[model samples]
Target: MGKVRKHSDSESDDGEIEFKKPRPAKKKKVETKTAEKSNDNTRDAKGDAIFALSNKRRVTVRAFPNGEPAIDIRETYVVNGEQRPGKGICLPLVQWKKLVELLPDIEEAITALPKKK
Candidate 1:
C-alpha cells in the first residue's frame, strides 16, 4: 500500500493559488424627477380629499369601521312644497347629494323643517 497524500490548499486550474474578490452588488434604477413629482402630487391630492357627506338636513363625517373615511347624510321631508319636521332617514352622502341634485327646485327648497311641539 502507498502513502495517502493530503490535498494541498493552494491549487488551481493551472496549478496556481487563486484569490477571488466578491463582486459588488448591483444598484437599483432611480425614478425620474417628473415621475417622483407626479407621485408626490397624487399623494397630496389623496390626503386633501376625503369621503364626506354634505346635505341640507345634517352632515355626518367619520371613518368607516373598516378604517375608510365615509359620509352619512339624513334625508329631509317634504309636504306640499314645505319641509316636514322630524328626524330624517340615513343614507350615503353621495347618494343623498345625487338625489337632491336630480330633484326639482320645489323639492330642493324643502330642508329640515321646524318641529312643532
Candidate 2:
C-alpha cells in the first residue's frame, strides 16, 4: 500500500485534483509463452517455417534451391533421427494465399453439402 498525499499540488497539475497515492512506473511489455496470436510462425534448422498440425504432420513455408517458394502441407516421419516429408501436396505461395482467402466460402459450401449415409 502507498500513502495518500494531499491535493496541495493541484495548482501545478493543470487544475486536476489529485488525492490518490503515486502509482509505480510502467514496465516493458512482456509476452507470455502461451500468448495467442493469429499466426504462429516458427522455423527449423532447414530454413523452413514449420506449423505443426500434429506429431507427424506439419505445414511449412519452404523455398527450394531452384528459387521456387511453396507452402507444403505434409505428413512427416522420423527416420534415423531426421524428419522426412511424406505423401502430401505442395502449393505455390500464390495458390496457398488464394486458398486461405477462400476458406470462409469453403466453410459455407461444406455446410451446404448433403450428408452421406
Candidate 3:
C-alpha cells in the first residue's frame, strides 16, 4: 500500500510507528553579478539586473518558475553581506510597459494631489 499514517491507538499494539523525517526545503539561489545596464542611470553597488533606489530599496529583474522575467521593486536587508528581498511588488513585463506608458499621466496625477508638509 501507499504511505499510511497510523493513529497512536492503532500503533499501541504494534510497538510504535516509525516515521521518516521531513527533508529541508531547497533554498532559492540569488546572484548579484555585474553586467551592463541599458538605462543611463549609473549602476549601483549591485549592478546588472538590479538597480538601487536607495540604501535599503532597489529594483531587480528576475525570472520566476514560469521563466517570465519580472521587475521586483522591493526593500532589502543585508544578510551575511547578501541583499535579501523584503516586502515589494513584482511587476510583469506587460504591467511594467503599461506603467512606462502611463508615466506622463501618472506625473500629472501626482501634480494634481495637494502638497504635504
TM-score preference between candidates 1 and 3, better one? 3
User: What's the TM-score of each model vs. the native?
Assistant: 0.22, 0.56, 0.55
lDDT of 1 at 70: 54
Give candidate 2's TM-score.
0.56
lDDT per residue, candidate 3, 1-90, as tens digits? 234455565535654455766777897665433334566754444443777889788888777669887888998876754666799999
Which runs of model 3 end up more than 4 angstroms from their true locations? Answer: 1-48
Poorly placed runs, candidate 2 (over 4 Å): 1-41, 114-117
lDDT of candidates 1 onward, in order: 0.44, 0.73, 0.73
Q: Model 2, residue 9: what's the lDDT?
A: 43
Across 1-117, the per-residue lDDT of candidate 2 in tens digits comes to 544544554456454444665778997544323212345566676656778798778888888668789999988876555677899999987898899999999999999999999
RMSD, one per candidate, in order: 22.0, 13.4, 13.3
**What is residue 104's positional error in candidate 1, in angstroms?**
3.8
Backbone clash numbers for all candidates listed: 0, 0, 0
Give the range where candidate 3 is weakest over 10 consecutive residues by summed lDDT: 29-38
Off by over 4 Å in 1: 1-57, 67-70, 73-88, 105-117
TM-score of 1: 0.22
